[model samples]
Target: MHIKEFFSPDHTRLSFEIFPPNQRMSLKAVMASAARMAAYEPDFMSVTFKADGSGGDQTIQISNAVSEVMGIPSIAHLTCSGIPKTELPAVYDELTENKVKNILVLGGDSTRELGEDAYLPYAKDMVAYFRERGDFTIGAACFPEGNDPALSMDEELRHLKEKVGMGVDFLTTQMFFDNEVFYRFLEKARTMGIDVPILAGIMPITSAGQVRRIKDLSDAALPDSLLRMVDRFKDDPDAMFDAGLTFAENQMADLVAAGVSGIHVYTMNKPAIPERIVRDLGRLFHA
Candidate 1:
């Protein structure tokens, strides 16, 4: 199913993200990890291309394993980094042949040699290209917390509306520690008349050092209260993990309560973490 439709509030689906390992030796680990994650039977699983930092035949190989072997509906990250606008159609056709019906269109992260025009420039361009053929459901990134220096919230709204006009089916937000930001984003989106299902992305931070680094990298505007708790548990690994899980649970429960569309967990290729978070959340869902 197209992720946009899958994420509807009426459906309330949950999904996960995974990356193929860089080295050949790591394939065993990735397969084992996928096996473990598959046991959870999420609504769908997304295989990333060049996640955080990595290299591989990222799209075809990993997606084939997930969709063909695991028999799970897989969404592949199709990037516009360094590729010309004309090149995307073939990749889309390949994914379609493999039964991958969803794609997250990304302009990719900036790097040294990448220069200013490192990626497809803006997401709308890709959305326009894909919408013409209408082969796959297209998704684009949104920053609910508004960290992009170049674009204000209003500017981002304009960009989102443009993309929607270009046929963006759904949106997945960047990780934000606080729920208020998501609430604000949803309000703004509704008011602007961009009414696609926006899946909330949560990254459960498992360690204190991770919190510090992620805060800087993501511009994660966590509540000062969370900062204080992390400070207290900075050296306590077990406590840090507990706190991370707790934070994620609370955020998800609140989003569900607020009638957010769906949940997308950044599993980081470790099934145990996402498994634990989902298992814990299941009780609330039941209750």
Candidate 2:
């Protein structure tokens, strides 16, 4: 189902994100996680794409399993970072053949070096490229906190407006720790007339190492409140995991109470995280 059509103001849905396993041996465990997550009855689930496209086929296969076999709608990530412009149509065809209807286009982390002829340079270009084909429900990424300090908030908002103008169906934010940041972003986006269902992307910070990944990915500052938790439980794996879940639950509860359109959990391939959140939130999801 197209996410735009699936969304309604009357019902707030929870969704999960998973990345394909990097090793062949890990595939079974990842699939098992997906099955456990599927039992939670989330609105949908998404699979992350590899920047190098080496695992592009695996992305589609996992998305197909999530949507077709597991009976949840799915979004497959497609990155333009290192992929040739000519290769996108085939990727779209692969998703279409697999019965996948949603896609999240990202600029990805890789440096763009796909020969001199590759023209699709950014997420906006990918959105426009696939938009021309008029097939999928296209999603784009946004940053509540500007992606980099070099880019002014105005400049970031301007670029985001351009992406939305390129026919984006919806948006999911880069994971953030503060709800206030997301609120400010929503206000700015509305003022700019870039209206679309914005799913607040969330990652359960289950380990101290994930804090580094969050910083590297989005330059998101760790608030002192969360910083203290990490400091207190940094050495104890079990305690850190439990504290992380509680922190995420509180964040999600506040987001839901504030009426965010959706909550997109960056599950990190751990099924238990979302299951626990849904269980803890109870019917607050649809409230």
**What TM-score does each of the candidates earn?**
0.89, 0.94
Model 2 weakest 10-residue run by lDDT: 49-58
Clashing pairs in 1: none
For candidate 2, the TM-score is: 0.94
Superposition TM-score, candidate 1 onto the true structure: 0.89
Q: Summarize candidate 1's per-residue lDDT along 146-184 as a digit string, tens digits.
A: 757888898989878888888888888888888988899
Task: Tell me, by TM-score, which candidate is best.
Answer: 2
In model 2, what are the clashing residue pairs, if there are any? none
Model 1 root-mean-square deviation? 2.6
lDDT of 2 by residue, 74-160 (tens): 999988875688787788788778988898998887655656457477889989988998578999999988886789988899999
Could you say which candidate leads in lDDT?
Answer: 2
Model 1, stretches more than 4 Å misplaced?
A: 23-25, 52-56, 112-119, 283-287
Off by over 4 Å in 2: 51-54, 116-119
